[model samples]
Target chain A: MEIEDENNFKLRPMKCELNYLSRSDGSAILAQGETVVLVSVNGPLDIKSTSQSIEKATLEVLFCTKGGKPSVADRFKENIIRQTCETAILGCLYPRTGISLTIQELEDFGGLLTCTVNCACLALLNSGIAMRHMVAAVCCAVSEEGNLVLEPSYTQVQSASALLYFVFDSRERNLVTGFTEGSFSENTYEEALARCRLASDVVFDFYRDIVKQYSDVI
Target chain B: MKISIGDVVLPGDYCEEISQVAEKSKVIIGPGLRKEVDRVYITKPGVLKKRNPGTFWVDSYQKRYVPSRGENVIGVVVQKAGDIFRVEIGGSITAALSYLSFEGATKKNRPEVQVGDVVYAKMLVASKDMEPELVCVDSHGKKGRLGVLSDGFVFKCSLNLIRKILNPNCPLLETLKNEWPFEVAAGMNGRIWIKANSMRETIAVGNAILGAEYLNDEEIRSMCNNIAAILAGHVS
Candidate 1:
């Protein structure tokens, strides 16, 4: 469908809970539509001498799918999530340390990457880790009719000709990471970027509300 | 989006009020707030707070302990190397506690510190680049409330709860102290060491502190009262 205005383009329903886990320093479970990802943050913890750095904290992201060992696809997801979060984290504050994020996929209705990235950011915020800024991810799919679907479902993504995911920082709304699947034209990519960027504000507002809810009394 | 004091804030949010004060004279940007080139951005999510005379900070919740200098902390002695003892202070790195830093300790005289001994100490040097150091004695060579802690129960809580209970206005500790005889040493590292006459009382102290995490001042007082009633109204 053609989305003309900012308000016309909509995101999937999102549900989130902060600090959901007991043991981790900070944890969150975010559900975007039917997809749900639980993320827990643990860090500025000690690191082995071999992997330790003198300038900043080492970040490790572990992405696990439901009821299976991690695979190559999971590793790729880990790399993207790690890179997206590493840019926002202020690692120099605690040098010679490490931060580890464990992301668990509870459900996958659609738009898993977007949901996972957003959930990871929320978990980081709940952990109160010093960050330069926060990031929000959005996904858009180009259907066979050459129309865009914002935050499409699993069936929509399966039937789509092209899929695009973009993560934007909260400060400038600049793109932090972008992942593309299948083939799309230059104009189609530009349109997807614009639409996804507009949809990211919803993700950011969701983050603000969740943080306020947990830190309200404190 | 209301960038005002007592209002919730998020990363990348800037307060014009802080800059207005900074333009006039000087404003101290505390933790969770960073002064960039043009605007002062927030790095943490919480309520924005401004102290009198020009101080700005974000009151946020944190569970992990980031060591700061001159804060009291409870640490467990992990290893006793020749001149220094490694104490895990819940930070990324284990802190170094010199044997000579203890009261009456010298080259020939060493404090009887063993492995896995909990101690109340102050952060001597907590630089991010260097190893954190701890001391059990003050400048006056007195071990005032800073030494090996024995016969007590130690538990970990959120850093926010620790600060809340330690705040002068918080009623959790005030009401609990009046209800029972207990001694508490709260560490900035999110650890609370409590010593009471009985194990039940010690557990009660821990429970009261944990339960007060989400309660306001009035609720904290009532919770303390309720705990007292339960502990006292029941059999020994």
Candidate 2:
């Protein structure tokens, strides 16, 4: 699946960053082009729980705007990120206590969900919240002329009929989370998935570059 | 044979006296009955020995005071022992203000003074006792700028910047001439007190004060919002 320029839609600028704060265990700011989101992770810290503290860690998520109000779309995005992050995080080691994560978006040009999840992954690493592997997200827009575009921007996404966001953990090349079309045929969905896997490689490479740049400072 | 304060004598200047009048020299060199002493001694050639004498001078590391018959000095009240309050005049030694010194104060009020309050007063007397003593009074039987500033915000910055801001022709200074109504007390020690202004105006002045150091126009634009935000108290 290819998202073409003739469709008047293009790939969004993937503006992402990691380990942006020192006070938190993990923190990152991901700006998917114009969409800027700040994500922070607070540890598997000590929590008073009776008896059942030995088995699995808990996950807690909070979402808010600059003024602390949760919009409907923000709530939807928060739930998606929470579910996706829970899948990627190592939930067994931190028993009894729930690790908390907060996502705040200052500016949203487009592709907010993808950027929020990507930033959450980096924030988990920054918080030193243990994770099975690093993960990344990219939104792909399928153009009318049968071209698959990776990381579609706000304008491109609006112009396109269908937009799909793929969240993947690079270690196992596993799909941790996914969002896509309902009306398209199975063939097109499969093609978009294939393109998504390829698009994920680009995000993974970007993730590795970020880690390499910040490894020395860490 | 007698030494006084601010006396200039040479190094080995007392050497001859050390032999002939050892007692008097001992009084000068050793701790004597004097409450305090200030002497400038330079090294000179010894009479019996052959040695070269070089000429070099250095001021003492101890505190130096500059007071005319009437010059105002600001001091911070640091201690209260018995009837006296010890005021630190930006130096190692403190000046004492006795209860009697507050003559103008009525008994009902009793001129309440406390530690950490900055007081401005004229030095009626500066003499050595156990330490330097200062009386807060004027000869015409009147109180001058001899009161305590007990409440306000205090911050420290370079003294040079303060002087620059106080300069009337300074562009940054001109911009803030009456923009913010604030009484600023700039100290030689770099402590500045900016009191009672709208938070917005105070921050604007602070930013403009900082802008004096940065001469670039474009560079300042990037910081303009931040400066405004700081004045707005949006950014802590």
Candidate 3:
């Protein structure tokens, strides 16, 4: 009776706290509908004085998904995150020095991985790690019928004709990173990028809010 | 727009930044732009400038080519012929590694080199008209460092990056010097072979160590951990 009542009530999955780690240099756990991600940032660690350069600090990014194994999908996500972080961190300043950031995704309930990267980047910035820009990410899936869907679920992605992931410096709206159409042609790529740019606007706005909330917490 | 490696006083078709001109020495060869006698010189493209001491890069995009005698290279076994193995070491036509070269194999029963095996050898001889010949012998004509590398991961990379990696004090080399847990041999040909217990860990470490030349250690380590974490499917 209780289960039937819950179903009949149309209750949705619960959302909870993000960035479960308090002392981590920086951390965040994002819940988007059923999808979830936990991210953390650490370092700006000292490079050996002899090895240190007067340039920019280094930048690093990592990604993980719910499955026990990090599939090709996860590797693709990691690279996109890395590119965005590189644009934001300004690595040329630290010359001989080093800096790194790591992100982990605990679950993938839907098309929320890109949002997770955005949240992780925001968390890194919030932690006061030096960065030149604020980065965010968004995804768009084009259906077989040529309809564009912003942030489609895993099932939708499987059914879609193409998928595009874009990472952006939200404040400036610059295209900081992009990866798409595992098997797409040049023409398809151009269309996906345009669609992704439109989808990125919404994700970037979300990043702005996350930053504001994070700064307020600090 | 035209470009060159470091700074462009004169622009042409090229990618990447020009770092600095190299000193002229007998080791410098090949063309585009090279540092010679402490000055930059642009040699005709697709031409082989005499080997000088100065560091140089191929201005064009081409796979590694077979080396002449006295040239060192790293290669991977990609195919097998009755008694010979097809080896690729950043070159166009895969070099031939004959079964008779390695000391123990006889004609009737030859040594087998499977796909994915890494070997560090020298180009003892090559002629434009024939398949390049690979020799596993040392300068003294000994077979001390010659053998089939059974366990390792091979990867393809840019030729320029490969050149940067071979020089002394190079970032990837330095990282490996700092107590690397695996055995790695980076050939001048852009083929990097890494052997370790954990393939995933080895790859993570390899990328970070190699990336160090272009990125800082902190960044590299972060990348390593990031890759490791992702492979482990763990959340930070």
Looking at model 2, give its docking quality level. Answer: incorrect
| Residue B159, model 1, lDDT | 93
Residue A102 deviation, candidate 2, in Å?
0.5
Candidate 3 has a TM-score of: 0.41
lDDT of 3 at A118: 63
**Residue runs of model 3 more than 4 Å from their true location after superposition:** A1-19, A47-54, A67-76, A92-95, A182-191, B1-236
Q: What is the lDDT of candidate 1?
A: 0.91
Please name the candidate that would achieve the greatest lDDT relative to the true structure: 1
Off by over 4 Å in 2: A1-17, A47-54, A66-68, A144-147, B1-236
Per-residue lDDT of model 2, residues B1-236, tens digit only: 12223333211122232233333333333211111123322221111121113112211111123222344556678998877888876433566777556647554546688778776665655432234455556655466545565565555443334544555555554344434356655544334555555665655655555565435334444455456566556678
lDDT of 3: 0.56
Top TM-score: which candidate number?
1
Note the DockQ of each predicted structure.
0.79, 0.01, 0.01
By how many angstroms RMSD does model 3 differ from the true structure? 18.8
Chain B TM-score in each of the candidates = 0.95, 0.48, 0.63
Error of 2 at B15 (Å): 83
Of the pair 1 and 2, which is ahead by TM-score? 1
List all candidate RMSDs to the true structure: 1.4, 24.1, 18.8
